[model samples]
Target chain A: MIRLDGVGQVFDGREGQVTALEEIDLHVRPGEFVTLIGRSGCGKSTLLRLIAGLLPPTYGEVRVADEPVTRPRRDVSFMFQRPALLPWRSVLSNVMLPVEIEGDKGRAAYRDRAHELLELVGLKGFEGRLPHELSGGMQQRVSLCRSLIRDPQVMLMDEPFSALDALTRTELSGELQRIKMELSTTIVFVTHSIEEAVVLADRVVVLTPRPGRVREVVDIDIPRPRSLGRNAHLTEVAEISGLLHGLLAEKEARPVDEVRP
Target chain B: MTDTKRSWLTTSPVAAVLLPVVGLIGAIALWWLATVVFGIDSYLLPGPQDVVSTFLDQPAYLLKETGTSMIETVEGFLLAIVLGVPIAVLIVRSVILERLVYPLLLMVNAIPKIAIAPLLVVWMGFGQWPKVVMVLLVCFFPIVISTAQGMKSTPVELVELLRSLNASRIQEFFKLRLRYAMPQIFTGLKVAISLAVIGSVIAEFVGATQGLGYVIQQSGASADTSLAFAAITLLSIMSIVLFYGLVLLEHLLLPWAQETR
Candidate 1:
């Protein structure tokens, strides 16, 4: 449902121009889950931002549902690593914000859907609580509810679970898989974790840092409801991890370019 | 952590009550001791007891003057809140608006509002309108600065998340930026409330025949030292009450903010 044709992002820095992404080409089919994996500053997040139209590409084009994305479209939703919950709003209100912002004055219109999203994220009983009152995991769950509340066709996530502890991360990874199955929305998620990418994505696009370009796209042939336990798919996860590890080593070995001159 | 301790202190009403009551008592004792030991002249500094007596003697008049001063303070403070938030939002929305308007705001704020008090009196005449306008001038800066800073400080992650959701600029402002800025806005409001009261009194002192500032002026002319002290005491009370009213309103409107960093 989304296509990036030679998408490149160049940022003007105090030292000079800095390229974040270069000639990147990507396509995400409807109901597909794709994860872009890379080390910090690999432009994975930049690619996601470009797809979400938060930032326009310096060159080439991004298209969603065959429409050139000049700006953010109503059918796309983005999730961040942090919960990004508004501290002043209750969980339910935060989830309902998109609807309210769309000037849907009728609370009755989206209330049932919002409630269902919250329940899907396992935040049913805590809708009235403030973001600050919840644990980090719970806050992120509230944010998930918010992102899904509008029932968008596309979901772009930038390391949405990277900040959580190992246990919560695993728990959320499972919940996310369940959510994906239920929602059936196209997703482009960015992550630095190979294990997470392997478990959650149908295809993992690995990139190198600084003028990031796709190094490889690894397909995960493992079945759904996957876990990081002693299972047959564990070998597949290990293989992907090894591939990611080699790319990271190569990324580190590349001599740092001095852009001052 | 300091935050934990603060939440603990505030969460328990008994502790909250004790801290302030103890602080007030300590301040009063210091004042009483300084007056008695130094043998300060009543003309220079009336004792707290004498000021209280003066207030009691003219309770009806003092109350009426207090009401007049309060009306002007409230009017100006409310006007500033209404105008300042939108102006701040506009500045945040556009670089051109910020560059064009920010320096002018600083210039207006820098021109000692007390100096404008007389001009306001000359233009508006020796009435409540001049006092209200003067209060607005003094209070406007804090509201504008805080609101602008708050809007500017909307978490980058949060902004990215909203953009990913295909939220419009207006949606981002109302749902995310505005809500996020509430705590900082209240911080400004708390400061502006006191300033508003002070501004009204200053304007009245410059020109007027009623209210606490006029009472101070009239007492000054007649060399009624005790009455001047009484007026000053009433002004102090007014300032405290106005500030606390804002604090109370903030607590009511944003209970969640109390726990935030």
Candidate 2:
């Protein structure tokens, strides 16, 4: 589990001091799929960085599993918008990177796990291929396998599938939901797509633009294998998407800080 | 049949190699025609046939000089790679070091290498040391710059991923940054090898008892134009061989780097 208490971040810019996030509070339960949705510069990514302990909050505290996070934790993994595979490494080598960095003592133990994860992501024979040999979607899948190879307690995904094509994005979203069920890991995924937030998250946390604040947390009461157009709860998916859209529209009228301060 | 058809296209490996070879032969043919038609003296621009015959006239002596020059080139180039990569690591790892040392590197790189050749001879004497040092000087800058740029160009997402794993500073560098920078380092090495060949030639021009450059100079004084042209031709062959040797090494070491794009 991850917890943020009154977390705020202010960055010094060339022009002046700039507020990226303010008076934030968030909690992600174990094995929960939570997605943060907002427009660019909403500080959604900044918040994710704080949770992953990649950056410290300027104000307040972030705790993971009841421990105050002063720095990154070995049990947390982060995925990026880009696959970020090393061009000189094959897929298997790229997936084995963390193990290599940590030490080779458990290399044999984790090699099988890496291969299984690769297979789970539909990249079985691709272990020998380079990142460039694959399409964009496939590259992202390799990254997914890489993140899962560590078998971490939490996964922080920052728009992991946004760079993919629309059809691939939809397909990956379904696959991600399945991966979450199989992996049973806590996840805090970030995206700008309302539909993506609706389809993938158990709870969608929407944030207001610049100097981001949690505008609303909409719960999706849909079963697994959810989709934008083909789910058993298709009507519910549409309703939740509509609700998220309205919340974003409401943000245009009222500044979150002004309303809640 | 399809392979044959495709091999004739612009992007085929066969065409890729053959086109350049054809162009080079055409250029030599044009030069030979110009000399014969204009009735130019062999003392000016000797014919290609005249140059080739000069190489045949004293193969042992000319080959020995070439071998000597080549040894210096390789020594200096290898030294630059060994020293320059670590310097790049230091600059990338420590901000204080980068701020302190980067400007000095730039200043040294900015000075014309030809200007340094005489100073090197004064300092290191007329042996192979001066030439080796000169090669190091010329090749060192591009190696450091390219390596540093490659290390710095790592995606923010990958850095965060490594951070989330709570990797040590050393691990972050050796595993992630260094691997990511390799394709680029080979790029630097390729560039530096060519410059390495040029550097030895400059050092020889300043003062040398033997080398392709010395042979060329000696021939120029004696008005043996064919031998001078022959020496120049040998220099070009040396540079071409060294450059391609590096390209081949890159292919072997980082097959994945080439596979992507």
Judged by DockQ, which candidate is best?
A: 2
Summing lDDT over every window of 10 consecutive residues in candidate 1 chain A, give the lowest-scoring window: A252-261
Per candidate, the number of residue pairs that clash is: 1, 1
Q: What is the C-alpha lDDT of each candidate?
A: 0.85, 0.88
What lDDT, from 0 to 1, does candidate 1 have? 0.85
Which sections of candidate 2 miss by over 4 Å? Answer: A252-261, B1-16, B92-107, B259-261
Encode model 1's per-residue lDDT on A232-253: one tens digit a residue: 5787788878877787778353
- DockQ of prediction 1: 0.59
lDDT of 1 by residue, B1-261 (tens): 555455666679898889999999898788878889999987788778878888899899999998898898999999999999999989988999999999999999999878888888789898789988888899999999999998888788877767766677777777788988999999999989988888998899898978888998999998888899888878888889888888999989988888986
Docking class of 1: medium
How large is the interface RMSD of each prediction?
Answer: 1.8, 1.8
Give the per-residue Cα lDDT of candidate 1 at B196. Answer: 89
Which window of 10 residues has the lowest lDDT sum in candidate 1 chain B? B1-10
